[model samples]
Target: MQDRIEITVTDGVADVRLVRSDKMNALDAAMFKAIEEAGEQLRNDPSVRVAVLSGEGKAFCAGLDMANFAAMAEGGKSSEHKGGAKAVPKTLAERTHGIANQPQYAGWMWRELPMPVIAAVHGVALGGGLQVCLGADIRYAAPGTRLSVMEIKWGLVPDMAGTQLMRHLLRDDVVRELSYSGRIFTAEEALTMGLVTAVVEDPYEHAMTLARQIAGRNPDAIRANKRMFNAANYLSAEDGLMMESVEQDAIIGTPNQIEAVMAELEKRPAHFKD
Candidate 1:
């Protein structure tokens, strides 16, 4: 079988692409495992300063595979455990992978990465695909890209960390309406709704440019900022302020931090050490 995901790291930026273009990169059991493994690979590589995620072909992703849904409709098993063993039926409430289940981990892992992640979305990002995009710290979409909270159409909800991610990016009512309707929205509409950072002619190219810019910053500081921002959503104002100070204290006067200052004074591009 062809690899579901492909990763290439260059100049501190890991280019992570979903390679199942034939299926619009839809999530199947193997695709889920591949995504999770890709995230973990980048997490362990200290040399990676940033990541840009995109799909290989026409679409970013088309959400869950239709076969899985068909199986569900037929009341037949739709997935299996690793190593091809039959999967033991389990409740969604089960936390199989930290705070998420197998499916949720596919997207949530991107958010959990220490380095920044930027999603380059094009074509369609439906249901679970949108959830995967939401996991990124930032998202860029092509001008006519289509998106939706599409699970409702399949008599389901966004179970792949979409609720947790959408609540933070969009207003409560907006998220509720989208979830209830499962309506497809354009990239322009998504930008207005705060679902996308920008809608450009070429999202992947723009995302790579931004990724390279971010990769040039002091790696320690960048990672620290990601950590602080991730915690900000859950922390009180007092704790948030304290975290700022803590992260600053750890980064201040460090080798990479000093290099950043020196490069600025020298008027040369910063040469950051991963």
Candidate 2:
């Protein structure tokens, strides 16, 4: 996985980078597997308070590799192989990884992580790349970075959990227009459309600084806040209120919570445990 993706944890922040800059970090079979594996690794690690994702070199990601498209055009399966043999291709409707398939999980896995994930997007994020960015809890993009729901250009839909993620972030009409047109939009426009959290001159640096600030807070409360927000996205108003109460109830009297209050009273940074 390190060949395609690299992860380094510092002060509870996981810095994840896509290293396939030679190909603009395009999603090939190996890249797909690497991304999923990276997410799984971070998900299982109790020490990771937050994660910042970025791509090395020019572009964040250029989406699906052109080779895969060529393979599909020639009637070859674009699926990955397992072990020493080619794995049988599964239908899109099949749920191979919980609620998502293999390819979709590459993007959706970030959302499954217990801690928040921030994406620092630069250059271009199209099709699958854009879907991956959507999976992050927060996204910061460099000014003028290009983005799109570009699967339509290749005669496909945004199947990598893009529709599910986008609907929550954008209006129905905006989603339809972007999905149908496959037109490139700049980060400034994405900020107006609510696709990106902010457009800045240096996204990675900004993301890391925010990650450090979040890491200094009470870990349990930060995690509970993320869980509550994620559930609120799909829960009923009553259920959402109950969830908030439940999460707050669990954290109110905890050691870390007390530490947070004491830290503020004492004018010192809280030291939270993993």
Query: lDDT by residue for model 1 over 181-238, one digit each (tens)?
Result: 9999999999999999999999899999999999999999999999999999899999
- Per-residue alpha-carbon lDDT of model 2 for 180-244, expressed as tens digits? 99999999999999999999999999999999999998999889988988887899999999998
Worst 10 residues of 1 by lDDT: 81-90
Query: Worst ten-residue run, lDDT, model 2?
Result: 81-90
RMSD of each: 1.7, 1.7
Model 1 C-alpha RMSD vs. true structure (Å) is 1.7
Candidate 1 CA-lDDT value = 0.90
